[model samples]
Target: MNTDESNNKGNIICGRCAYDANPRGATHCQKCGTPLVIASVPNSDPSPASDSTLLVGGISVVATVLFFAIGGYFFWQQVRVASTPSNLNNSADNISSDIRLYNSMKEVPKVPEGTFNYGGAVVFAPLRNSLHKAINQVYPKFGLRFTEPKYNNPGQNTGITMLLDGELSFAQSSKPLEDTHYSKAKERGFSLQQVAIGIDGFLLFTHPDVSIPGLAVEQVKDIFKGKITNWNQVGGPDLAITAFAFNPKFGSSLNILLGPELDQLSPKVQFMRDYTDGVRKVSSIRGALGIGSTGAILGQKSIRPLAIAHGNSKSYVPPFTDDGKQVNATALRDGTYPLTRRLFIVIRRDGTIDEAAGVAYTNLLLSQEGQQYIEKAGFVPIRN
Candidate 1:
């Protein structure tokens, strides 16, 4: 090889073919014809930030922290509100200022500040009188005032009608709402609900001057039907028996208590406007016999209840067992009492009780203290 040729064949080697050295300034491997690349050091210079860019980054971090803090605060507030107990029905020890003390810890139902009217079976007048005093004693701040209860010259039927007609805030019923009345209520877009307050029994009573003890169930049926015109037929005086009762339109309990026997009663039987009137009539008439609630008759010294016979039984029982001192609560509850009836406080089904005086009154009657009033009113309490 010549000197210039040997100088040209330097130490460079073709990476692709691993061939012998190539000449200087060559861009590719000569033997394989492959392109070549040379490695170089990377630049370390960074891009500079502007003033606006720094401001935006700082604001983003602050906003993220603030959003998390605000979300946490709202979640805590919701938990606090949810954890707080309702003030309306809290226990006595935890009562709020807005709630008033009742017979116990149970908050007295707060009613609207207004006078409410009530009417119903005249027989329940004693119960009303008793409740009027008890409610006032327990919850004076309830703000509901009641006018004198009106007998309305009838019984449950009149009271229920008046209640549905919006003339009364509540009605005290001797019986449950009839199917006809229920349908009538449905037509008006509401329904009736009842709270049984107490139990009452129909009393076959007469003026104290009469000497007769009691009558059998069959005898009473016959007397009211005009089948037996004279008292002598039932082992009484020669005087004619004068039957007095509530008119058929007044929803008399006798109709329900007497059952099939009421159907046998004469249509012409003398009817009174109210139980008090019936009682008054019997007091004056010598041979008059009338029926009313045992609670009502027990109050009148002039009236006396008769011993009534059970169906087909040879034995007769008095209205009271303890020598006429106390009403037979057990007999009445057990259906052994022939003329037993239930008394109820009626309210509208659409939550009207929340704002009405009737709810307070019912609550009072159902309370442990309220049952005493039932006994004071001469009726059997549904609860002890």
Candidate 2:
């Protein structure tokens, strides 16, 4: 064998025959015709270059994974913070403010810059005195004003009539709006809307000296209807029951208490000029009973309120508390008292200054501060 030929770079060797010196690109050995195998170049190691490439690729993959993991952790933290109770509460408050659509006296909407005449039932006197003064103090630049009826007694019916006649910008009422009131406002080229702002109830009252158990609602109704004329019929002395009530024509108490039966009152039921007059008469006359505003009757020592049961049910709820001095606001608010009713603010929807004034007044009354005033006035606030 020639050593120089075997040492050539392009030489092929026959591994089966153990022969060298095969020509370049030969597939078999020439001497024995055995299959040839190509030999690799001498001293050419690739481990350093291949290992460096692998390391670089591994580092790139790890860096990419870490970057994504860090970004994901920060994103999760942000989501957790956004769902916290304080943030959720802020979102809920924003939604509530958007839905309320009304403002309190402190944040009152734009109102007409002039005096506005307003009046209502005598039961609202205390509320008006407190609420109106606060309104004036909060909105002095708005020039809002309130006044009573100039020509007659302030009452539910009177205030509504005056509002239809354009004598008042708004009115307060202890009774629900009637069909006749709607018709009258329609005849005057406008519609009347009543917004409930508080809860009230009618109180069955008598002289402090009258001693008797509580009466059923039906028995009280029968007494007022002249069906039961004797106090003995309702577990009292054998004295004749003289039922006195306010005139339904002027006051809304009978209308609210008796509903459509306002005209069914017995001829024996004497009509008083006002609640004060009714209280005075009942306190002075023996065996005399009358119905008046719970708000007005509370804290009156001369007269006593009776516990009233619903129909024949034995659960008698008194208009006053157990001590008989303060009003049973809980019962009235929960409708446990059989004589509960709502008080409203009547507004004219004629797109005039009166409407703006009335809406502003209603918004103020429906505010939290205004409801506090209502509670202070001895009436149950409609809002929590």
Best-performing candidate as measured by TM-score? 2
Per-residue lDDT tens digits for candidate 2, residues 72-143, read 575444434423333122221111111122336676565567888887677776676677788888876555
Model 2 gets an lDDT of 0.68
The 10 consecutive residues of candidate 1 with the worst lDDT sum are 1-10
Every model's TM-score: 0.67, 0.69
Task: State the lDDT of candidate 1 residue by residue for 208-314, as single tens digits.
Answer: 66677677777777777888888788777888778888765676666775676667778657888776788889889888888777787775667677877776453
Q: Over the full model, what C-alpha lDDT does candidate 1 score relative to the true structure?
A: 0.61
Clash count, one per candidate: 0, 0
Q: Would you list the C-alpha lDDT of every candidate in the order shown? A: 0.61, 0.68
Question: Weakest 10 consecutive residues, lDDT, candidate 2?
Answer: 90-99
Q: Which residue pairs clash in candidate 1?
A: none
Q: Please state the error at residue 157 of candidate 2 in Å.
A: 1.8
Quote model 2's TM-score: 0.69
Clash list (residue pairs), candidate 2: none
Q: Cα RMSD to native, each candidate?
A: 31.3, 31.3
Q: What TM-score does candidate 1 get on C-alpha atoms?
A: 0.67
Per-residue lDDT of 69 in model 1: 65
